[model samples]
Target chain A: MITIELNGQQQPLPTGSTVSDLLSTIGSDGKSVAVLVNQQIIRPENRPTLMLQEGDQVELLIFAGGG
Target chain B: MDLLQLGSHSFSSRLILGTGKFSNAAVMLQAVRASGAQLVTVALRRFNREQAEDDLFGPLSTIEGVTLMPNTSGASTAAEAVRAAHISRELSGSAFIKVEIHPNPQHLMPDPIETFEAARILAKEGFLVMPYITADPVLAKRLEEVGCAAVMPLGSAIGSGQGLANAAMIELIIRESSIPVIVDAGLRSPSEAAHAMEMGCGAVLVNSAVAVAGNPPEMAEAFAEAVAAGRKAFRAGLMQKSGSAIATSPLTAFLGATL
Candidate 1:
């Protein structure tokens, strides 16, 4: 099992849990949103099939309109 | 053209540019340069991790004589806006804060109450506050009361580029504001920007229009020239409104009529 911390929330996931797997678990629509891993932005193209490692930190950001 | 004094910086160009929606960093840089904009708006956020080197901040930082007006674009409430302002001040080392508080994402309108609250707090804290608001005259006055450097009333919904949606309110704001009134957002073309300037707006902020143009650099240059011309015309004073054409008769003709 790998410890996945999402937006400061800690959770345990099965080993080899890819970013796709995490998104499926989290129910993200994958539109107008950005994903970050360990303080690094993960682009959409790389979000799928990217395996997770131990103690991985993830953040999902959704952009909205503002002046 | 009037030069607006905001905080410690003085801006001669009335065209405030936003650093977003660029096709590339090079295009953004070129467009900014061509725009002759002394003040550029940038969104405050973490660095993108995909690129080896973050080109956005670096190029913008290197732009000589351009002041970075970092905006609290993501903040939803007064507290969040204040926090973002604090973080921006720390990162940019500037006291200028563009206080933006919008809870809704669809219309992107300012929450007048929250914006006013944040502005009051930020003003008391000695930060130069420029609140982005709707073209509401009363809210403009409130912002002014709170010591905002300028009131940026939106010309229309942000990123809409649908042109001025609240012309009457904008006119009222321009008429009533003691400090500079900058028309920000929803300006689609050079004509719209020029029209706002002609309406006595101290400045206008444009982003999506130029950034999303086919040739951003060329578009930037066009906007710069258009703004300059508009300001010049405004200073020169435009012609008076007339319902119908009248024959021009000199005052000397009055003496002949009397005779």
Candidate 2:
């Protein structure tokens, strides 16, 4: 198992985990979430192919009401 | 009136709505419909799995004719704002971005340098960048030169309801800017929206004025009408102001005198 930071929280995941796997593990739809791995944005189409490295930082963003 | 054009997109309504501070999604939807706003602004924040079900994307999707404009609020630096803009595009599927960089929490005044930097970056990235700025004509022109789609100058501080405290400066910005000038923030009522439109602004974006009203939908309708009236008035050409009142009838040749 390897540790990665998800939304500033550390989590353990199996080796060779892709961003898609992370979404499945977290039960996120991946449709409404914008994922950033190590401050680099992962486009929705590219998420499946991109693998998450150990100690990688990830942030998920969503729409909120604002003026 | 002609359509409101920003970048490659054209919208029918001149009033842009901000989707914030509403009590709920239902009211926000009603307000958007009643306001006749073709574009609306939203913010991006950390997504929580537990709150995913109640996320705003679903209800906002239901409102027809409204395109989402994601704002990079709470970002103090250009890089942060750019990152937020990219994330916003991914989430909303829209290239429209509102570059809002307010480092100071208390004042919430947009940082001009950061905003300009972000605008340049976002514009180069092929995003339709609309920066929120102070009523500075020089900066407005600078932003336009950077290929920004529009310039949104604050009428006053955000949510202050002060109603165009910098009207003269804003007028200058509108006159100097090549792109659309959208008067945003600090508008207290429909009359203020009308006033902004009357000043030849391409559009007016209001949030607290409508969302915090006693009845949001009703207020939205009022704003829509006011904006339309203002645009019509502007197009028709308002009579110039004069120091002395002029008589409707001729002074030398009155009704009986002419006869």
Per-candidate TM-score against the hidden true structure: 0.77, 0.93
**lDDT (Cα, tens digit) per residue for candidate 2, span B136-242:** 99999999998999999999999999998989999999888778999999999999999999999999999999999999999999999999999999888989999
lDDT comparing candidate 2 with the true structure: 0.90
The TM-score leader among the candidates is: 2
TM-score of chain A of each: 0.82, 0.92
Candidate 2 Cα misplacement greater than 4 A, ranges? A14-16, B249-259
Each candidate's DockQ: 0.06, 0.70
Candidate 2 residue B131 C-alpha distance from true site, Å: 0.8
| Candidate 2, CAPRI quality class derived from DockQ | medium
Q: Per-residue lDDT tens digits of candidate 1, residues A1-67?
A: 8898876778788899888788767654443335667866566678787898888888754321122
> On residues B118-217, what C-alpha lDDT tens digit does candidate 1 reach at each position?
9999999999999999889999998898799999999889889988888789999989988888888899899988888888888889999998888888
Q: Residue B134 in candidate 2 has what lDDT?
A: 92
lDDT, residue B118, model 1: 91
Error of 2 at B178 (Å): 2.1
